[model samples]
Target chain A: MPSVDNNASPPSTKKPLYEASTQFKNWRYSPDHLAHIRSTLNEAAVGVIRKTFEAYEPGSSSNVSFVTADEEHLLVTFYIHKIGQLCGHFRFPEEVEATAASYLKRFYLKNTVMDWHPKNVMLTALFLATKTTNNPISLDAYTSHIPNTIASDVLDLEFLVAQSLRFEFAVWHAHRALWGIWLDIQNLPNTPPDFAKTESAIYDSALTHVRAARLTDAEFIYTPSQIALACISLVAPDLANQWLESKENTPIPESRVDIPPRPSSTAISASLEAIRNMITNSGKVPHVEAVREVDKRLKLCKNPEKVVGTKAYLARKAEAEKKAEEKRNKKVEGQKANDRDPFGQELGEPAAKPGLVDYDDESDDE
Target chain B: MDAVERENSDRQKSWAKEQKVGEGTYAVVYRGREVSTGRRVAIKKIKVGQFKDGLDMSAIREVKYLRELKHQNVIELLDVFSSKTNLNLVLEFLDSDLEMIIKDRSLVFLPADIKSWMAMTFRGLEFCHRNFVLHRGFKMTCQVITPVLRWYRPPELLFGSRFYSSAVDIWSVGCIFAELMLRTPYLAGESDMDQLKTIFRALGTPTEQEWPGHTKLPDYVPVGQFPKTPLRDLFTAASADTLNLLSKCLLYEPRKRLSASEVCGCCSYGSPLYIIPISSPFRYPSHPSKLPKCSTQMAPRPLEEVDGNVDMAGTGPGVKAAAPSKVKLKRKLTSPADESRTRSIARKLDFTKQVNSP
Candidate 1:
């Protein structure tokens, strides 16, 4: 028999709720905050694009375009789903899919879809998530499914995506927590003999909801365990209630949650409330809108000369060419100088002159 | 500058580097202090120049795990920031490590002292395991020492198991416990083959009956018959219970090895020291009734009787109790050849460096 010696205190994955609160404060985003950030980014991008265009056509304001938060979020969600499909085609681990989705979500949090093309960003996020999670695929392998993409396209933006997330690549998934909870139920005393098949069915259904829950911003607002519990509660409220009752007296792991081991009933209820709110909030289908104009504006930003040769673009290009020419001229001059004097004369000490004061001799005389 | 760069610069300004304390393969460590709080910190500047990739894999793993891990024994990563070319991880400043203490002949380690260290190591490891983290590499360094001593690495790892679990760390802790008893590396081998030989020699050759899948390992090889050395023979001074626990930890089968929590539960068998359960809210058991009654001869001296200034935590500055003169004399007596041997152990794990004020 397995030794029960260390069974004095059973290990658990449930941390205190405070850790969840801190994680939320660190990485979570409220809808209002997302809206505020997205709008601000859109306004800034539009102002820059407009100013650049206006430099070429002094009186034209018609070319300036803006992406609404709704349209931008729709684009983001579309690409996130695209990332999931891409991972599925690649047959990467579930973590790759989760991470790619998370990367897309996090990237859009601080950035506007107009600033960087979502298609390129989405591909980069998938490529990076694949590499980070240890199922590293070559750039060729990564871009094989997507057309008109190359290694540099994804490789160049890797640092940008990583920097946006501040290199915090660790993402918790509800699947593991849900699996743990299911096992906990099976291990409990007097679990029905035939409960295994039903438990598997319940778990499968709960996992389906968890996937749907991910398409929402529940990850930002709630911990993985909370989301998992909420997913279970949605399908198997009786089992969840049973699980809650079992956990009522048993203390939660301090590592998982920073709160008291035996949390007050109010704290537990408040968590349940937050999880329910997340599930409901996620249930609503997002309104989709056209983002063609925004995409065009982004394309124009990449190559302003394509649509209109703005004075600023022309002048900047001319200045860059002039600098390059001057750099070439300097290189030619340096080579000529080197040919004339192999050991550069300026680097050698100045020739001693009779008229120059000998400071060392003077000091010796003193 | 971009927003990411701006944020990084702000984080950089918050911590003030006092001086360069140590340097290793992957990072240069600095003694630092938080600007506002004046709290001591060790800033490990990771060398990004080597990897064409943005950040080193080990740095990423360290940050990924250490950021979430919170325990007294585990080294805490306070903040992570990138400077012009290097990634700086602001870690809790730990002054010394087990290697230094073990090497210092001036200090004598009692059974109680070893027990305390084991308790703390297991406590930290138990949390890591429960959190689904496997400290694949655990070695003694200037920072918080881990269980994966080269001499202590488990047989599975040596056999090249890519998907090993927490059992690997238990083998390391067992090696450390034995090291404490022997005052030298128990199985310090020159090479992988030699190391395996030493392990087998000490614990007998594993057959299919003993380790069902031993032959299936990628690097596994058949060794000639060798009788197992009795634990009491190796650890002559250790109690019977201590020997029993050691055997469990060093079990050939990875599945049979006691887990970190299991090790914690068995603490009563080996030492009077209270093992702190990772998840339990209760403090260390204080009641004498809960304490196991062991032979008085084998029992450790009362905690008060041990040297108070020895720095048992291994997180504080080098022990002040060891007389400077004696330590110097001991160093002087050791041959230059012996000094060179000390450098043989590669300092691969560069997590934190203790900054000594000159």
Candidate 2:
């Protein structure tokens, strides 16, 4: 029986929903840890792809260049910008645009551009975002919008990209969180008399900053609410500070001792400032020249098995087909046996007990 | 049942051939056990690349929201993986839902059972509502079969009001609570108009004075005036406290409805529900595990995910909540690290496909 030991934790003083989010749980990392993961993944991919190139041609790897972690990051960033442009072309909402960008960035964290090209992955991620964000566009309509693209180019990598995302698609974007704060700012007690006049302009500017923040590591490092607060501060520092002060002065319920004390206004401001700086420092789109060089290297290093008309591709396809064929034959036999006694159990081993490996073993005999 | 015999039988045959346990429009549910822990799980295998568009909207919504949600009341999405071109969601396989139990003529629902179900469902709803998640409308959806959804819809939605809130879920809970008591749907509307007529007949047609801007709703039209039906007439056995809670949930103004916290009797607001004391027969809403195998089976099919949070229905305890045999998803992924060396003596024969030739 599933344990029911946590009954004491009453419904009162529930943790904010964002804290339980997969974004906070699985995706977060310290800056040092994030850098370490990327470097390690890049190095491992380089070593493995190097061997594959060598196997294809003697000493070919030495002649070719490998993409470094930084170069891969630069190239993925370039694609992230392209996603925004594509969204504009398609007239997709901000949620779709941001989600696609989020998917591409998250995908690269788990994978390298060399294994799967960013171009194909970006298109797949965007197409996926259209569905996930409820902005559905027909595949034909989507393919026609982009140049030199086919349906397969996007559809083929859909599974790979979805897996890389670990199927966590409800991204808490900074822009949405910013909208909440913008609403709260209107009702603040000490709102500037003339604040209403510039509210739209201020929000638009903050939205611009939030868009930039998407290109950086701010999402992994900070909460959406925190990022939004920072964006608000970037556009209207005094207004944000005043709002924080009002919150600090307000007393929390006496019964809720478990809830942490509000951060001092200064501390909140300092953290907000740090977040703004993080976005401002590293959030610019990578230069085209720098990205083009990386893209050139990516084409040469991309998995040969994934590309069309490659020997490795044909070999892998044939092997996969053979495995599928054998499994199908085994399934047919199992069905024939079942036909003899439709109401009875499996003619041989019960599938539940044998596991998939056992099924493979059974197929090996035939 | 006799008229669509062909269509119905065709569905049944296809369902039998397709899956051992369950099948939906976009996915099939297979029963599989995890080899490692021997843990029971339902493998919801979604067919990918089968449509002109890529992954199904329902599959994406399932992963997107369910992955973020982790509550005892909500079904657990154990894991997700892919094999070939299929997306698989590993979910806890439970046997039954509230709908089945309510519909089960053999089982009797005690007043305490009714309270427990009410409290549990409300708590699950409260968790969504407290997060400002407008369930059944936008951020999250409660997808059940049509009867459950239509029966649970609040008046505002029936009136075509686009805006929704915690009050929306409150109305659904009220309907579910009524079903638990009556063992029949409270207002089983045959159509949207009939649904409103049924509601007005039972609870009196709302006027501008009662609902405050009731006539201004997008779908609002001139509705007939009907006196409110007495609670005693509908729920002859329900206690006074039960009546109060039910009435609060069914209030005309969306804001006037009781929040999940209040209904569960855990609120700091001068407890309107204190009369239905926690120490009463409804003992802290017992965990589903404590009961028989009537646990929830969650197979999230795609519904709308955008701004208009239209709901499927009492999306609570009964949608396709059937306990499939335990089965866990196994992935066959292509890792980035696979190196094979084929030491060929020479390139003797060259064969190439000309499929891409133009």
Candidate 3:
């Protein structure tokens, strides 16, 4: 038999992993990526919370609806804030945020606002953030601050979320290119320590800008590298300017008069103008105070006091276990009832079966 | 009353007369009598619980295809009905199958008789092939020898594999033809592998060059490489006309094998219906309805004053008397060579024992 050339194409331009007739085509996303995202944002921290509240006061009455809506909104906002906090805490590569955002967007594509609570969705987003950065957070600690009701459906929802995304979780972020540029600057001969420090400041400032941009519509459109660069240039222009000034002041350590000089202030100013135009056209910049406040509240609420402590935690844990036990019992009872009434008697099987079978048999006999 | 109640009542009326005939993988065929019409029918009962995967689409493939086949040679499907627990298929009852006749060694056929049987078998097979049905399990058992023993299988069917097209049925026809001539199975191996070797010994082993896609067959493997043998060696005692027809039917390549219609055209023997009347001892009264009309008309025989004391040995010019010397010669040349060669290949085929037969 002739051997097929499996490696004829490069990895970047490989064909679809699944065949056309495969059932995976029907699935929302790749199986593995869906699994990864689901595990990270287990429904225990998000799904059950919404269900519990909905069940506690079930009705389409305006008051009930309004209350649920308010709580849901608060929960979603808290999740977004926590994501921002994780962004700062982990010093996650800018790509991690972009990856996390993409996961959240893709997850919601198949899912509805009503099906899974925003809380679990947020926790999953954060969990994905950790993974995208190559840093995994334990599910135990991740769900620790979640209310028992919210935490109940976390694990179950994880699978649903993973399925929704189709498991293609490879996300590229903007910070990768920024880091590349930093590496290039570091290798340049006679680069001073202060100049490097200034450069580092510029990188930090870039991250801040990226974080701010996330709250705006611009985050939806810009790639991670573009966001990172734009953010850095916007946040800490002085540091970048100072680094350039130092280079110009302390140049010619070697007889390199023939060397091409760095770009002048005029060129730098023109480039800055172009970057500003790009950012302005992208979207309205979100308010800095609002972004910070949301970020702080997210960090604080992520580990709320109600979710911590041995006794409170155990009580909440036991409550969750009890609810799960009830649900299991209900399902088993339903199955037993179905088996006992094989003819679907609840829909009046006794009246239906005789007429259907008896007439056909007689006609055949004749 | 609702449909279910009416169906149950109808079933009860006929259920008492239902007698089991055979059971397949998913259905039980029962001999049934319609009380009102007094018509005999074969009812296939399929129980829902017996199916491992519940009533799936594949289980219906055979029923759907068979329903459309309306040829005289093919079994007719009359109706289909379903109850709460089972699906019932109503088919026209066939009296006795060809396998039972073949197994009854007491019966013997003349040369013309064998040729007529071969011709009918090919006619039926050609119809099925043109209609795009493979009849994958075309053993003697599947072929119905209506009224009496007569060959009606194609060769491709003799080569039992589900993947084949109509060519499989043609292979079974070849096997039936061999059985008619020799009064035994051409390749009666105990297992599938044994059967392949049996075919190889008689037809000679197929090489990759001869059968271009043979290597791609799911069951294909290199069993001890045997040199090819000519067809004449296998059918040494067969007449020139018979041998030519047999070789065409038993071609190794499915595409190269003669079609069912082609087999009908190539048949040297006349219609089997003439042989039936000649073989029967009863003298019939002159009545047109009593006699079946052959699709192709035969040369008219003298109707009045026909001699009831006609000689059995010299009835027709086409009929040949069985000779002991010819049988002995065939047995000596082919059977021993086939047995010894199969025994050698069987030893090499033992490695396949570990793999479970599907």
Candidate 4:
């Protein structure tokens, strides 16, 4: 049987990592080097602290401060593992797990853990990921699949995640790229015969490395094809070198081996090192007390009044209510006129308000 | 309104929906125009919460692939925005589809026209396959054909092969090609079992030697031995080049079935549709003055008559039409045509109730 070139074009060609990463990064972090609207410890730290303090001002008390970027990362990383476990239990395709984690990671970058609890947001990401990956389960089955969950918990937060990500749902995972590289490597004339026998093991180990790479910020920094090549290099450097060298004057059609144009060997080494650094950096486990404190502060931040309970909170609530009331009254007034003046336009009335007329007809049902 | 709702509305306002064009099981399709440029688009508003699930799988699959696939032949997913819970998919608004053209009995299909449609279809499929995406429900879709007829479901699907690849779609394209020539479904089998029988009767019963590992399929069943009917006989009017292309696609072994790129390389489809003009001794009647009049009347006969002739092997097209026994038998029992007629009647009844309905 002819070897089908499993490698088509890497998904990164359609959407580069740099462009997609910037959208997510700018949303969470500040554009200026100095400050963020919300900050994390590494790059966006100050912004997160300021936002948390602004949202949850416990009467000038110093007790409920924002969590460090590391703590935030730890909490998110923990739940991402949970997402993987859940996906595993459900027998979801690997793409679902990858997308779910990507969404969760992107969500936390812009939002404080305090803003939206990871419990529901985590599950929502999975649900939405399943849909985006073309393996959607019924909201009922999805909720019931996990213990003590309901449909609303997942559905309600879907919009929030989507909006935060700017509704850019096309996510590229390294698994496919890795598979492509593996296929190209196997077909090479230089591959050892024993390599064919250990093919499954090598594939599994490479996949595990790819999965590990997902936890790092390398996804935002590098293209999927680069990350895939980097992972392959880590697992088997000799094969990776051979695969890279095989590119020159190769008889294989470029379309059949959908590898992105190879970066410089130095660039490849640098990316692999970055991936290694990320893995090493993420190895540190934060203190349990720190994580708990962050969780406590997050609850208060989600419902700020619970901690604030100040006149400022009441004043803000009252103002919102007043604005809503005024809007509702104006809507009713418009609907009454529409009902009374069916031929209002003929009578030379105002060309009905652009958004107002449609709103009334839809909601009022008359 | 909350910020999210406001944002969603802002996105929605960009597209001005003119009117609802059609409805699917899980979507309300609207013919819309972009507010800024007045570009015509099809807005498929996927109905939320139909499945106990959050969103339909078909919607997910469509969006997942459409976002990445860029081709003139394929329907483009221009934009996706949510209006409350419903996700509105702005798509390229195609004026007509191949199925609509084939179904319009009044519109005679020139070999050139059929070739053109096949080239476009195969080109699109080839692009999708090259990108490693599968059009799982190909010919069974409403966009391609009447949704209920599983006639184009490949033998792999019938044998309960969950791991089938792009070849499944290739098989379906073969059926579409045959339909283009026959002017009716090539195998309008009612059930999965019946579908296989129809396929085998038209082609031959697949032996283990012919389709290695076929017996290992989950639902594989041994059927009575049947000899292959020559493609020339079944597609009576097809040219040799067209017949050769059709057989390659309809091969029993999926791997033996032509890939989209390979199909494109065939003698018939190798060049542009009009490069070699097809000269025919028997010219089909030209398109009727108005298509609807002939379609409403002529379509029913060709449909039932095609099936009746297939079943009674010796009877020719003339005999099938003249035989009162076959007509009464067809009417007494439900045929696909009868089922469609019933559906049309139901559709008419629903017209009176369309007022104030979503």
Candidate 5:
């Protein structure tokens, strides 16, 4: 018989509430109002950006970066993290996250991190980005995300962002750039050292960090590529730096020394600085406490070696795998139980009863 | 009954009771009475189903355009209502049509009265023409003659061309003017073709030389071409000034036709032909007892009661009856050949010829 475990954790319930509260205090409002403010602000910002871009560079070529295999996994990780944050913060539909990611990718094609303030641009891009993607959240919903206290002030700021970008909502991301580079690299022999493995690891780690960062308003300050680079550096610093350095084709220039050698470190520092400045300027220490929780998780991944292949890692992995297996078994058993319930008879016997007996014995010995 | 038909029947019955007017093809014009206020009104009930597929096109066009048209002289469409089965059009009730006045042998309009009617006709026509609406169906029947004998129609309308301009109304006005003078229809053709021939005979058949676009008319045909007859030949008895104004209005080419506003300006009551002395013996009897008690609020009563058999009533003198008979004789003596020629001429002036020609 299937184990009736309705008590199992309802995924996403706690996270969204936590996110909503955090977002509310920071914006200083309830969910309903904040959504409207966020939506309005987002719309105004995107409109400004679109107009600015078109005015400055009418028919300008796209500025996309080519990625290396070592960087690919890290970029993917960053995008995953970003998607998580979007899901958590805005409580957006999955489709919105997908659309935002696509916009980030496309934006990167014609724009570099240095071209505009990624912080302002990314938000504008996201705001405008919703239009092309099906199931758009309203401008009111976006503006409502803003804190009630400074809501009026933020309205103008949002308009400025939109005007700066000339209303172009589309964006590009490093994940696609990484993929393109990977495809290109496949044609050549002599793979870079630990490139594939490091990339894959970075991909996993970056995803988690990006998701966490998205909830914190880091997107307002950092470009998608910078976020991606930071996540990669956090997950696999050596590989990310090597990949970046290789593309630069020069020794660490003296001028760029202050800007951390690793992309992930630079990205993290930028995000941290932005958050710290925002907290200090807002004069609200209580809000910082909530942000600290996010900061702690970010720090764990910030120094990846602390978590990599540790007992904690293995334990977490094992537990996750076991839970997944149990879920599959439960589904199968439920189907069988439903079928047998009609006749009041048991169907197939439990497979490998011995495996359970052995596990029990092992638990007893421990 | 089907759902739609039953609803329509219900609407028709209700509107008939409400407006208390007669039914038309597209609408049931009713004499409405506001239940609370007891104010009398006219309501026209339009059926929605009947409007599908250009069937209700004329009504729709009238409503769409007339909704914006606010004029004193023109009939007013007061309000509209709609239901599942019918679209209701409410209009102001007028007393009588011009045909009633024109056919009323007892009512011999003074020249000044005719002039006033002509002036009002032009004013209404001018407003319509300015708004780019052709009163495609202007006729004595459509014209609600006010308490006076006014030339309420134009000539182009009398000659049946639905696609005509304000010139059509001007043409009807010309016909009304002629009717006032002769006490009969100027172009009383039996059919559309006959009407055109009557117009052509009186106005003189237009040639390609005289009317540049004559042959280009939709119904234009190369009949054995006749020479243009001078205006003098048709209205030989008409005053010179009246003839000039009449000739201008009767231009075959629409562009050459006098505008309604121009007619208002040019055709004066002070003109010799229209200046009848007040002492003239042709005056209507003043006694209400001598006349039928007609209701101005209701739609026109039957013609026989109002105009026909006026002599039998013996309310008027014998001289009035003899006057029309003598006028009819004068018309017959003028031309038997012209009448026969006009009939053959009408046969050649088919509307289909115009439609097919261009």
Candidate 6:
């Protein structure tokens, strides 16, 4: 057989590692695609939530005002800030803080605030980010930071958030990319004598822009490097331009391994423009008054099944618990078999012959 | 089931779960085949313990790391789904690991076989390092897929170094490389202190000059000077080129240690090329499939009498590492694999020549 590399078409032969990341392939989108996905998810969520609302009280869904995709976006943005503040409160590193916000943002892209509110999802997203970024904290310690919160509040939503995000934990934040650019910029020839001071100021300001960019649709719409460039351009346009110019005409060695693609200047400029515009326009934290209004409206529009004590929530929980109880009972019954394998009971009946073993994962986990 | 539940169950049903392979502290390993393609897979079902925490950190870390890395040398995580009220991770099925192959007395270790395994490990480590992952995983994670094997912890951890990076993995690569040749763990430390002592004993005690800030580490303990045994002496039969890689990897200073890419020999401009160069004489076969596998059924069973005991120190998360039962295990490579390997090596050499010709 031909080598797998030989089998692969030329498109991905020497692409940089980030290009293969889930953040690049799965999370990235054009502005239109991002809008379309949000609206589609919102529309579906509204329709399903409307049924639940009406089912509880006839014509109640019509009486209740559901949040629009834009409004949901506003709520999610507000929670992203909460994640940032939570990270601050916990004194998490920048990566943890940014990763949590990114997780919350990505979760809502697939899920809706109506089905799983970003308020709860934000906690779990931050918690999961801590783990993925290798700065793990106990659930008790995490929840204790927030008043009236418990371990289950964060724990229950973890799998759901992980599921919603398709278990892609590695998110390449723009700040890291910007840091790379900062390092590379130093390595560039003919730097100003005080380039350190100048670059530090620019980097600090660009870091702010990059953090703001996280709240925008920039991550979904642009690659981290592109976004980093955009942030740098926002801070010191000349520096960003010089960096691009320095990188543009670098000789592609004969081997041509790991060359970051040099897109045409116009194409890169357009992408940078879109990214910068996003960072400037919608990236600020949503006004608290505006977010509060949306949050008040969200109370009426939420999927009652997710609420703790609502009839729908109780009914859903009872059904799930009943199914689980049945599963446990069946497991207990299976445990009665006189013979057993090392791990667990066999799904099939016990073997008649001695020294014969069977394989069944029927009741595996505790 | 709603969309999420339905989707989860559908994923769960896609693989037909078969025999139990190995069980871990937090998960169970089951050998299964994907129903769609009949492709064999190892299903690691992470036990959802009495719901104090939502998921285990090990499970999350394993899934997170595996999902990002996709290499033949690194174990592939095929799928992940929540089923039977627990998380099930579908992994590529590998029947055996280096520990088993090394331990089997009947199996002869060929130079090419050692090179093949070392090369695969280096490639996998390179990928991990490229992704900015510090492959410091030291859990009892079995198989070639786990870049951080339990037996291969670097010395820094013992000396209580917190801020280490890719260099740590290079040290492990060095240890693994050495182990491949010696057929024993190069720095087999029973405990944290013992491990450090073992490492110092083999490769002399580091002075402040050798490793700057040697005394400043949090857990640094004074061990009397032991002259560094020449690596070639310890690895007596090893070629100079192989010993060169070992020294580069086993450097005392973390900063001085060769990176994964350096060991893999990156020639791209501005990349680390401390040791590996384009024209380096020694190179391992790139393809791992052509490498030797433990047939597991040796004609002469040194381990047949021991029931279910292969003395496997650590098992991969899933997959059948050693022959589970007392069934005749492969301690010998079949004659065809032997033939294919030589053919593969020749083909690789020709391919290398073709590339270098330009």
Most DockQ-accurate candidate: 6
Clashing pairs in 2: B32-B326, B32-B327, B32-B328, B33-B327, B58-B302, B136-B309, B137-B309, B138-B309, B148-B314, B149-B313
Which 10-residue span in candidate 5 chain B carries the lowest summed lDDT? B349-358
TM-score of model 4 (CA atoms): 0.71
Better of 1 and 6 by DockQ: 6
* Candidate 2 docking quality: incorrect, acceptable, medium or high: incorrect
Q: Write the per-residue lDDT of candidate 4 for residues B1-358, one digit (tens) a residue.
A: 3334466677778887765566544456666788899876767676554445665444454555565666545566677777556777887654333455556666776675555456556765666565565554444223322323368779887887756667877887788778878888898887778888889999999988989999899898876678997888767777776677788889989998988866543222232222111335422222211121112311211111111111211222111111110000000113446432321110000000001100
The candidate, 2 or 6, that scores higher on TM-score is: 6
Model 3 chain A weakest lDDT span, ten residues long:
A1-10
What is the docking quality class of candidate 1? incorrect
Native contacts present in candidate 4, fraction: 0.17
- Please tell me which model should have the higher TM-score, number 1 or number 2: 2
Instruction: Tell me which of candidates 1 and 3 scores higher on lDDT.
Output: 1
* Alpha carbon lDDT at A80, candidate 4: 79
CAPRI tier for the interface of model 6:
incorrect
For A213-307, candidate 3 gives per-residue lDDT tens digits of 44433433343444555555676655445445555677553333324456686765665554445555532333456545544444422321134
Which residue runs of candidate 3 sit more than 4 Å off their true CA positions? Answer: A1-366, B1-16, B23-25, B56-58, B142-163, B207-209, B213-219, B225-237, B265-358
Return the lDDT, model 2, position A297.
77
Worst 10 residues of 5 chain A by lDDT: A354-363
Q: What RMSD value applies to candidate 5?
A: 35.2
Candidate 2, TM-score vs. the true structure? 0.80
Off by over 4 Å in 6: A1-13, A187-190, A198-200, A257-261, A321-363, B50-53, B137-153, B206-213, B228-236, B270-291, B297-358
List the candidate 1 regions with Cα displacement exceeding 4 Å.
A1-14, A17-25, A29-63, A181-206, A229-294, A297-366, B16-40, B49-56, B142-149, B206-218, B239-241, B265-358
Q: Residue by residue across B1-358, what tens digits does model 3's lDDT show?
A: 2222344445446532355555444445566767678676666665544432233222233343444444444555565555434656666654333444445555454554454444445544544455444443344432221211112222222243334445545665666677766666666755445556667777677776767777666556554565667766766666665666676667888788766645443222222211111122222211211211112211112111111221222211211111000000000112344332321100000000001111
